[model samples]
Target: MPSMHRKRNKSLGLLELIAIALGGMIGGGIFSVLGISVSMVGVFTPIAFVLGGLLALLAAYSYVKLALYYRDEGATYSFYKKTFPKSRLVASIVGWWVTFGYISTLALYAYTFASYAISGFEFANSEIARKAVAGLIIFIFTLINVWSVKGMGKIEDLMVYTKLIILVIISFVLINNSNTTIPKILHNHEDINILSIVIVASLTFVAYEGFQLVINAVKEMENPRKNIPRAIYSSIFITTLVYAIISIGAILAIPFENIIQNQEYALASGAGEVLGNIGAELVIIGALLATSSAISGTLFGSSRLISVIANDGYFPKFLTKRKNNIPVYSIITMAILTFCLILSGNLVVILEFGSVTFLLVSLLMAYTNFKIRKHTHSSLIVTLLSAIGLMSGTVAILYFEAITKVEQVYYIGGLYIILTIFAFIFSYKRN
Candidate 1:
């Protein structure tokens, strides 16, 4: 991975890089988070999405600066280690935090994939059925990724582009067929406040996370200084538009009660009542494609990160071994943990856990970028604001969890405690 220029006969261009970012970001984004956002913010859902996008762009600014300076595919973990070389414990902790964050997202995508894939079935709401389907999808993607990296890339290209079109059409069709206007929605939900909307925005941070996957391709792309910013910024901008449009359409067309009731498959259930079967079918297809590609891309990218960490001796050495250039142990280990997360929590719990994990991790990245702003050519104000925004987002999530479901926060806190213990032991052994 060191000789990045010698990656392939043809390095990734801006278009392919954008496709990867969009694929990663869009996959588990709208389809998974929309219902929850709507539930929390009512007619203000699009506003939350816009706020979330702004936060994403802020986080991206720091990521791009660090990426241009480092140019390593190890990405978040690698950047942190290089920035604070002597702080082995913090670096080891960051590696663990980021890797587990990916696992939670993999679980999020698979959970959404199952919800939409079986939305039309008799057992759609069955907990057992949902988990079984989620696990099955994970199994299928795991096999595809390990069998051939080239094959996985091609499938990714197809799904990424096709899902975008489907999602656009679904959003337009929903808005065109809306039963109520935004004004009426506003009149009914007049009590909603800015703080609530911002909380939802913070909780929805997980949806914008895949943009970092672009930096993970540093070794596969050209001109890191140029392409990293271009690809990540462009993808997030485009995705923000996509999400805001979808949020507008969803709130306009889908009844809040129905969306809240069917939270997991909100679009599927509501699209059916609003536009009949044709619209529902469109949403299901788009969601399946979105989540499928997301699961594949995440598993592929995160496994490589695991391989890097294990090679650094933070994890079991066997995870660094590969067969046919595939990190088989790392990939399988991630999938199993993803299923475990799904089994342990419901949709909201998983979503909150993932949202909090990524925000904290990105916050750490922002702090690291600020610590060496001169070397990264980063501005003082932008880096400070980025850290502040990420910190606020993390605090907002904890506040939301504490307000709505206090026990959920304890569960998430316990999980972090376990991860911290693992990170400590790993870093201690290295000493």
Candidate 2:
């Protein structure tokens, strides 16, 4: 049985939860993945985004069900504990891996913002200037998080609202200016198959991973059981619609070939091409806001994970200590790790490895759902569905890893397994 010793300050409202979800989901992936997605699926890139959203919705449903039943602070960790008491060590490993993945994602978004800001300036050709700007941005945000999570949350709420308004405006503009016939969706496509769609869609689906972070906020939610589900589903629905319209407009504004060539900021470039310099600037600002909001939210959530782990006796008890009713040490630890990762300048590799770790954790979560159904005699239908959804998503990610030849996936997977073994060995000896 998992014990909840510390009570959380449940001050987050539905808007805050929604802001976190939106902030996490709409990070740099939206700006960065457009070219790659276009390359993979052609004009059907928008369709791939919608498909990713549906799959994410499925995962969210599973999480909602588990949250309602378990109501534990550990999120996935607690779910696994209820289902596999003896496998507590494995659950802890999964939880840590998940936290690490989100941290890597934060690094990726920070790097993306640096890349965009550098490219926007006349002195962008100066390598030293570029690095300095990137480092300064990371440092500023790290300080923001270390100083106060609640303060960061307030900033994120404002940032998220601004980004949402921008997306809505962009979508409205696209719909109003759509001169191309809708038939081009099918008529322009030359080839479409399961393999191609999944290959292309996986990139866009990465954006949808933001929904997972909402579960971390459950402890802070006033009424998690009801609010979490509503927020998750509603955010997904709105983001999906926005992504589809923006993607299609981007493709129509710029030729598919041109979009593929500008791999970095395809959406912004397309916006610039169609809507001119002002539109491009708006999108760029949106990108910055999106990335900053993501970093803030991840810092908040990952600190909670650290606090949970410490409370479980995995680390020094100091990590569990709270100041002003907040886990100060845990938050600082997360900021330090993120700062170190920013220095590596290997943000892309970190993201791929992070995705691999996350996939493994998701797989474990699904398995836990399945095991819970078998052991506790609870409703099996949703659990089974959740397991299937997680498995499908995981398999897709693995396939993506292999196809992309990201060798880091194998190394990360092997290292995590080794760590899991060692953690258990130490636990056994200590006990």
Candidate 3:
């Protein structure tokens, strides 16, 4: 409620809150996902993003309501735990799944950061170099987070705002130099159907995953009642708009083959081919800023969630320890796990895992809101719609992975089994 600019404040204002949410949402999201989306539905990429954003917005409805009622910085896990205090097993399971989902997203962001950060170098293609940069950036942001919340917020504000300006410039330049018209592209891809677009949109749920990070900062921000909904909704709307414009520009200007071939760094590579070095470098810069701030915001918020869950006996107790109220152990532990994920998995798997994890976790959150609809003052119709939409998104994603990458479906099932075992053990101990 108070201005953070009044000489070093303890609380985050609306601007810093929006910066954190936007930072997480935009970072590595569009940059890494563009090519895959284009490959799936061609010129319908922006339409998919818009539809995916609607899913995100629908999910945000419950998040905002629960955040205000519970007012807990713990967010997803806390909401479920509080809503179903008697079901320790369910609560513990949700805790593990949601927490690890954030970890995977953090890994995805860090890995994306490394890819673009070294794109111009000869060693950029070297696996070792990319992993090293990923680890290094995670370490750097970990230090920033452990140092101070205010410091991290300030740095996030800079990166987020600067990237927005650069994205606008990139969008304008790309559209101005367009090589194809929307109608013409659509004619060529007339076979693409609504089911494919919806599936593609579900594939994009990962990009919209970070809006809930705003609720993670509830304890540090002022006026949760007002800022909570404002920050989350505003960030989602803005991020969707930015992603649409950028996707439109890329689809119209860059060749589809180029985008598909250069999947890892499509925007940067395509921009380079179109506008030469300057355009490419601009995209690389935007990618760097996006992932950097995303890494910062994800680590900052997820650590707090971890600490809270640890205190509730679902995680390692050591994670609950904090240095100067910063959850240093949780932050460092998450960074280490994230780096391990980066080392273990390739880019595509990491991205899909993050998206799938978030989709499942958000569905649970929507279910939580539906359970407490009356108490949270939520509309029955909206709650049902949110749950239905999230369920459809989840089924859509799993269907895609099942049909295309059946092995990944097994891999995801294996992960859930392992997580459920841990959740069971933790719940048993708590009982």
| lDDT of candidates 1 onward, in order | 0.88, 0.68, 0.89
> What lDDT tens digits, residue by residue, belong to model 2 across residues 224-335?
7678788889888877876888787776666677677656556566677777788878877877887778777776766776777667765557889877656778777776
Error of model 1, residue 3, in angstroms: 10
- Cα deviation at 346, candidate 2, in Å, is 4.6
Q: Count residue pairs with overlapping backbones in model 1.
A: 0
Question: TM-score for all predictions?
Answer: 0.96, 0.86, 0.97
On lDDT, who's better, 1 or 2? 1
Candidate whose lDDT is highest: 3
Q: How are the candidates ranked when ordered by TM-score, highest leading?
A: 3, 1, 2
- Model 1, span 296-334: residue lDDT tens: 888887888898899998999999999976789999999
Candidate 2 similarity to native, TM-score: 0.86
Q: Give candidate 1's whole-model lDDT.
A: 0.88
Tens digit per residue, CA lDDT, model 3, 38-139: 999999999999999999999999999999999898999999989988989998998888888888888888888888888888887788998999999999
Q: On a 0 to 1 TM-score scale, where does candidate 1 land against the true structure?
A: 0.96
